[model samples]
Target: MTDALERALASLDVRAGSTRRHTLPAGGDIVLPAGSTTLVYLLSGEITGDLALGSGCEVDAPTGDGRPVSGRRTLLAGDAAMSLGCRRLVLSSQSGAEVIVVTAEITPSEIVASLPGTVLVTGFARLEPAAAALAGNLGPRPDGLACERPGDTVVCRSMIRSVLLSAVRAWASTGAWPAPIADPFLARVAAAVEADPGHDWTIDHLASLAAMSRTVFVERFRDAMGRSPAGYVTEVRIREAQRRLDAGASVSEVSRALGYASDEGFRRAFRRHTGIAPSAWRARALTA
Candidate 1:
């Protein structure tokens, strides 16, 4: 995985985007806004951070983990889960630690499911996501690793997503808790959703076409994908939005194409899920 990191990073077009790297002194605190997803990798030294995921929840090292107070280590060397959108976030580092905090300009599920490994560790509030999914964990490259680059710090963010999607697919075949996309009905539904991103679809309608009772369909959908029917639908919408925007659709046009009742609603939802406004993201992600 380490060896692959460099190459993977090189392949990513992040150069078109922007990232911030910091050498945080111990006791440093950084504030992050609501509805943003970040990937913090401990390149060197230990660091502990706090998270506020809204809904009156907080992720702190001292009081949350319920570990032995005396021997508590605030931060260890590792990666943080992809934080889901929430109210705010706080991060602290040891006296002299090096870390790469990649504030992703993408959606939560889009980036999380696209990580390198199926099994990923998250932050305290679970605001972050885990990469370790039960997927192909199958495919052509079980040993594929994150990409690396020519710099002091290595950040193969794009490569990680590719590897994870592959891993998740592999594990699905083995019946990992939530199986991968192996069910034919589910596959058909996926195809249908992708084929008609503008369709005003419903779960009941999908269930009928899939030839299963609504209850059965819901259960199977969750069992196979680890997300509710609506959740998956939202995912499809987000992906479709990306495609349309990349193809040069205005925000309103993209929203209308996705059957969104209002462009404002689409914008809000897009920011909540992707951590950036549609226009800003599109400008950076798909420039000719």
Candidate 2:
């Protein structure tokens, strides 16, 4: 299960946007806007909040003992909270508190969809010490010199990435996400697709690999994976394209490697899956 989550996290394209520190006075509440992924780590304070989720949103949180907790409403010092696809987040502090909030845009949407809409990790400092260490050093500089020095952006981004990774690892450890493909035959088909995403995957070929008839394979694949084989193949290809692009591969190179007949074909498919052109995506990743 951890391996599957690692693969999913590896495929995600996380672009950290801004990191801000907020001080909430007693009885004050703040409303965070929607869009992108948001992480809130309590530096030294207490907060209570409600998440307004739009359609298709899911929420999960784990307590200090790594047990799943539902409808979590409060966060204490050393706790970390995350939300995606929420209409807005309303947080209020009964006693004054301070927090560091980071915003990021993570893609492809399918991968984000697979994650819970909200994740609150209690005792984050103990559960993810490395991330806690990084977070401890993050905030507005005392002199108000924000990212003004050489390599500051890169260093800040690296810290944000580490913190985000730790939060995800914590959530995944609780076994809250969906289970992996259960059927052995379907699992084999998924493995093959992932192994060679550029292959000319057809229903017949995949069914043959699974040792099942085409109709049976299609039905079972959808049942186990929640999508048709062709859809899964497209997803796998797009995931690979994101990975390669983030690794500094050119658009044409990724196109050819993914078995697309032309750059335009790959561009269209990539846009359809990720809602952005591959080149633009790569550029954002580079600057991020």
Candidate 3:
């Protein structure tokens, strides 16, 4: 089976949106709200903070050298933090600090959900040298000037994208988070489903692909993936449907491509998963 991380990185898509810089005076505190693609990097000085994560959110920090000691911890220069969902990060600077906050949108949004909701990388420069170099290359663009220049924006976004990828890679290498599908057998099944979501992936077919009996496959798949095989297939299909829809595919076309028996069936499944119909979701995504 292909390495899980490699597969995830391959499917990952990120688009940089807005970038902002903040300078906090000594003894000042700031509340930063985090979204699915938010990243905060400390440029200088130190700050202490606590993360308030919402339901279904998770936090991962270093357990040995850089771990947060309690509910609040301090981050030094070159440190970074990210949250995959809605969160409130309260930061306080003792001797002042400079930070850059960036927002991006990631596709295959499920990848974000699979990752830890909160990631604190203390001493990030040491852990991810190349990413750190990219961050350093940004220097200090006065008053967010980079965002104003189209060419500079492109270069900045590219560097930020690399930083995000490197951060994920560093965290994943630590094995602090669970792989989406840990079992080799189950991973094979998942790879096949993802590679061809339109395939008719019945339990029997999936089991055969995994070289296991249906019963064993079902049990193990649930254990590893936290959902039944059928549910997983539905999830994969819906995610692909979203991607296709975002790419300007019509609802009917998506339904057909994903092997739905009828447009109505696809519509129902899409609404159940996203709480929005395919057409509406496409419109919103396109406009956004």
Candidate 4:
């Protein structure tokens, strides 16, 4: 099986639509009304920020009096506020700071939903130690400015998504997997499933991995994933197939590779899950 981290990273795209670098002096502040998904990477200096996702507000490292905390970190926007109207993002610095803000093609909700947790809720949280390293890589490349190079924005987007996913997994490991799926044993089971969705996963096999009975595993899996074990497997299969289709694989090729009994069966399953045939989805994805 591929490493779980690799699989999770493979499941997301971070292509950027735009990128800009900013330098802020001490006491500098900026307010961005939500529209496009944004990632603010603090290149240097201390800063504080807040995220207003709808009426719910989350401040990064706020002080006793409820002021935003000052520290260098990464900020990810959750919902762009297109449907909800707009989120308020506030950033301030006590000292000078440099940041590169990138607008992604996809929203925070889309990224979070693809990952295992709601860790992107605020889209304004600090990155984990491991994720911090990846975020740090977003600093100016030795060759030249990132935006100066062709296709560099696309690469930037992938790196940002990677950093977010790493941080999310770290947060979830510290106790964020929901409900019945909160058990460490079940988390491992979930990881294995994601690591190799094409595996012939049965309730008994998954239960053994979790050291639980078939019935217990089934119940917990549904609670954590909101679906039966079989249902989850089907979803994973379809998602993998979707990724392949988007990458330009033929319908027959995807059907065979994902272990579908037949091409027609694969077509039926894909349509049932995505409301579009694989070929049609591919066409739309290519045009998109």
Strongest candidate by lDDT: 2
**What does the lDDT read for residue 198 in candidate 4?**
76
lDDT winner between candidates 1 and 3: 3
Tens digit of lDDT per residue, candidate 3, span 1-288?
A: 135455455435677777767788999876666555677788898888765432222223344222223366677898887656566667899999988777777764455665655677777777777787777656457554433554776677778888888777666655544355557888889889988999998999999999999999999988888889999999888877877777788999999999999999999998897776888888865653
Clashing pairs in 4: 14-157, 76-123
RMSD for each model, in Å, please? 12.5, 3.6, 5.7, 7.9
Q: Would you list the C-alpha lDDT of every candidate in the order shown? A: 0.51, 0.78, 0.73, 0.57
**Residue-level error in angstroms, candidate 1, position 108:** 4.0
In every candidate, how many clashes are there?
A: 42, 1, 0, 2
TM-score of 1: 0.44
Candidate 2 per-residue lDDT, tens place, 99-139, comes to 88889877654556766667778788887888988987787
Off by over 4 Å in 3: 34-36, 52-70, 137-150, 177-202, 209-216, 230-288
**Ordered list by TM-score, greatest first:** 2, 3, 4, 1
Error of 1 at 281 (Å): 1.8
Best by TM-score: 2
After superposition of all CA atoms, the RMSD between model 1 and the true structure is 12.5
* Root mean square deviation (Cα) for candidate 3: 5.7
Candidate 1, 166-207: lDDT as tens digits: 322222222222224688888788668767867888989889
Ranking by lDDT: 2, 3, 4, 1
